[model samples]
Target: MRFEGKVALVTAAAQGIGAAVARRLADEGASVVVTDLQEDKLGEVAAGIGARALPLRVDVTSRDDVDAAVAAAVERFGRLDVVVNNAGGCIVQSAPEDTTDDDWRAQLDLTLVGASRCIQAALPELVKNRGNVVTISSVNGLAAFGNIEYSAAKAGQIAMTVNYAARYGSLGVRFNVVAPGTIRTPNWDNQPDTLERLSKMYPLGRIGEPEDIAAAVAFLASDDAAWITGHTLPVEGGVLTGPTVLNPALSKKEYPGH
Candidate 1:
């Protein structure tokens, strides 16, 4: 029970990585507020996790919704100690020339803008409590992806994480980012072949699981990382550093032994 008696809020926690973070924190004795667009699924996930779980329906893009979710956590539990913003998705892959306004907006909403809302809504409480924030940024933020819009949004998110840390460090509110590579989730459940393909591509010989990312998020949000802040920790199984086709033009000697 690393987080015994602490309170945590996790966004997009109905399923996938968010769900895993919520469940793990609860198992460690933290009272967790789980938010998602799917309220029924949220309840089911919350129930499965036991007494420390409280689920709320949320669309992270909405500031009011984000505020309400954070407030509810304090109202139901005793205080706020940690927050993990894990609501983003890679819903944009089109090139800038081919991308529509909707494509840009949707990806930005989910990745960068949505995270901004949640962080803003959580700040006062976090500052008061001297709590921590773990934002689920992406490897795309570090390296450019073929998807222009998603990459831009994610890069913005990484910047936002740094911004939060910069402004709040004096207040003792820590902020960090966890950028996962290819985590195994329901996203691949529907396409088993796609999952297998991605797994084969990883240098670790397998894709990551929700728990893998959850472990990192929990560590960042916990007191174990008390001295850490304003960093992007990549849990990408070397994807960000390894020999991926993303930049195949580099010489082996230039990028070797990854």
Candidate 2:
């Protein structure tokens, strides 16, 4: 068990990648604290993950809420071994011109600021245990993928990870970011042919599952990656590697070596 006798706290863990992460950690023997604004859904996920899971209602946008949640996890688990800052999303989809000040701030507050708040609140405990932090970034963060505000916030997280790692490495704490591509979650639900279209963009020819992200999160949070820190691991099915498209005309053209 990679996480035996360890404690992991995950935010936005009611569903999607967060839930999968919580489950994966718990299955590997960590006592996981799963939190989200959706208390009912959070409870369901916790229950499914078994006795090793604790579900808490947490609104990451609030500093007080983040602090309280961290305190609660420490109180129950005795210590914090891992902190996964996963409470983030593209709350508003719009162009820079159309994006309201509120829209921009909301993305920052929820994704970038929220993760920072959680890290700040958990730093004392993390330092004590020499633990790790795994933040969920996105491929959009690494490029201009349309969702302007969200992409910017995600990019901010990558910066945060590197700077934090540099600041806290001597203290025996590690920080890393996982940049996922188009994950198949409820966010894509009812969007006609959305998954199919997005799948074509990845070299793998399929969209990612929540569990795929979970597996990467687990590895980063474990001792296997002990020497790894201040890094952004792209679990985006090679979308950021190169073009997935193939044209018959382009393929037919070959060098003299052929």
C-alpha local distance difference test of each model = 0.86, 0.92
Q: Write the per-residue lDDT of candidate 1 for residues 178-201, one digit (tens) a residue.
A: 988888888777888888887665
After superposing all C-alphas onto the true structure, candidate 2 shows an RMSD in angstroms of: 3.1
- Candidate 2, residues 1-258, lDDT tens digits: the string is 999999999999998999999999999999999999998999899989888888988899899989998898889988999999999998986768999999988999999999999999999999999999999999988987888888999999999999999999999999999999988777788974989988888877789999999999999999999999999999998788777754122333464443
What TM-scores do the predictions have? 0.90, 0.94
The stretch of ten residues in a row with the least summed lDDT in candidate 1 is 241-250
Q: What is the lDDT of residue 50 in candidate 2?
A: 85
Candidate 1 deviant stretches above 4 angstroms = 244-258
How many residue pairs clash in model 1?
0
Best by TM-score: 2
